[model samples]
Target: MGETPWDKGYASPPLGEFLTKWGVTGRVLVPGCGTGHDVRLLAGKGADVVGMDIAQSAIFRAEAFPAVSRECYVLSDFLDLAASYRATFDWVVEHTCLCALDPSERSAYVDSVCAALKPKASFLAIFFREVSDYSGTGPPHPISREEIDLLFGPHFECVQSFIPTQTYPSRPVGSEEVCWMRML
Candidate 1:
């Protein structure tokens, strides 16, 4: 795939706001972190962070993140994490990653994230809402709130959700919103 249109230049606003309130400066993981923008932002706030993506080029771009430690960025499929890293993070923050996957894969996504968290650790996931198209062919395959609730409710607690006054500058105007949940 050529440049993912989802790779807009900065950390997502609603997510960024959530992180700020949630606190940085601890073990954190950003899975499917395209271009590592949010990882950079998290690290800037003193978070000890890892940014993982399936693309080597994306990993290369992420490795340049000033705040991520030298070994922090890894090129790996989120579904298959090594044993040593299991339950290793205080938080796992998902941007557009889960939404980008086929809906059938959402449970595995939830499992992988759960396995990666420390006991009682939390996860923060952002979903895009209000799409007009729904044959579900998109890499961005949009998700409804009910689907989100069902998939994550068993393992996590809904924390907060809100619509944004702003979105990634490159994305279509008013095309997305953000919701965050914490691990139970």
Candidate 2:
């Protein structure tokens, strides 16, 4: 395959910074983890991380990298996670996963994340709060605070939420948000 527009070739800078302070451990799940960049980040922090992606090529590419710990890559749909993964993860780290889901599938995505985490487990995510799309149609969908509250507030308690000062070079400052939510 040719160059992917979204491929960062490394773990997200914000994620790396967060993990540095998070002291991550236990089982972590990364849905829509292309090439396992973020997956390896948590693994290096001593967490047993699993990276799940729908693309076989992504998994193949991830496996080609030198693993830091018990990190594993799997080819599977995040929307239809395996039974073994149900309520098994202590953390579900989201980067671009949320924006990739269609608006209609957002509920399903939320359900899947709830199912994937143990009770009271944390779900940490960096979401696109605003994008350049005029029609509001996108894989990189922009989400607002009200929409997040409407979608996740019922099932989770917000531990922390903030707008990052540092973001990807292409993204405008304050266009991204990070939320640390715990399962109810």
Candidate 3:
């Protein structure tokens, strides 16, 4: 898969605003954190944040960002995260990561996220609803509300789920599903 242009910018506006409004603090984990943009944003908000990506180059680029110097960045696959990381985060933020995975791997993704979060910890995610012409040929595989609920409901309780008025320029206005769930 080609590198995503998303790898070069600050956190998406909706995500940044959500974290700011919620005042999320304490240990947070960002899996598939392309270049630590969200990591920097979370750290600036007083959250002890760690950004993890399977790509070594992404980790190197993240490490070079002075804004993330005090934060942690790891090179590792989320599905294969170390046992020591289990139940270690107060929050696990999911931005574009979920849609980036193949539909088949979503179950593993949910398992990894659950394993990494503390009991009752929060999982914040923004999922892309399918567009009419979506062909399923992408790093950003389209997702639906039902699929999301089915994948996470067994391990979490839905706290909030809605379509965000704000979204990235590349996406449609009502195409994103934003959800906040607490680990069960």
What TM-scores do the predictions have? 0.87, 0.94, 0.92
Pairs of residues clashing in candidate 1 = none
Q: Locate the minimum summed-lDDT window of 10 residues in model 3.
A: 1-10
lDDT of 1 by residue, 147-184 (tens): 87888889887667776665665455456656666778
**Candidate 2: which stretches are off by over 4 Å?**
1-3
Question: What lDDT does candidate 3 reach at residue 41?
Answer: 85
Provide the clash count, candidate 3.
0
Kindly report which residue pairs in candidate 3 clash with one another.
Answer: none
Best to worst by TM-score, what's the order?
2, 3, 1
RMSDs, each prediction? 2.4, 1.5, 2.0
Q: Per-residue CA lDDT of candidate 3, range 76-159, in tens?
A: 899887988899999999988888888899999999999999889999987777654788788678787788779998999988
lDDT per model, in order?
Answer: 0.77, 0.87, 0.83
Candidate 2 per-residue lDDT, tens place, 86-158, comes to 9999999999988988888899999999999999999999988888753776777888899999999999999
Candidate 2 lDDT trough over 10 residues, lowest sum? 16-25
Better of 1 and 2 by TM-score: 2
Clashing pairs in 2: none
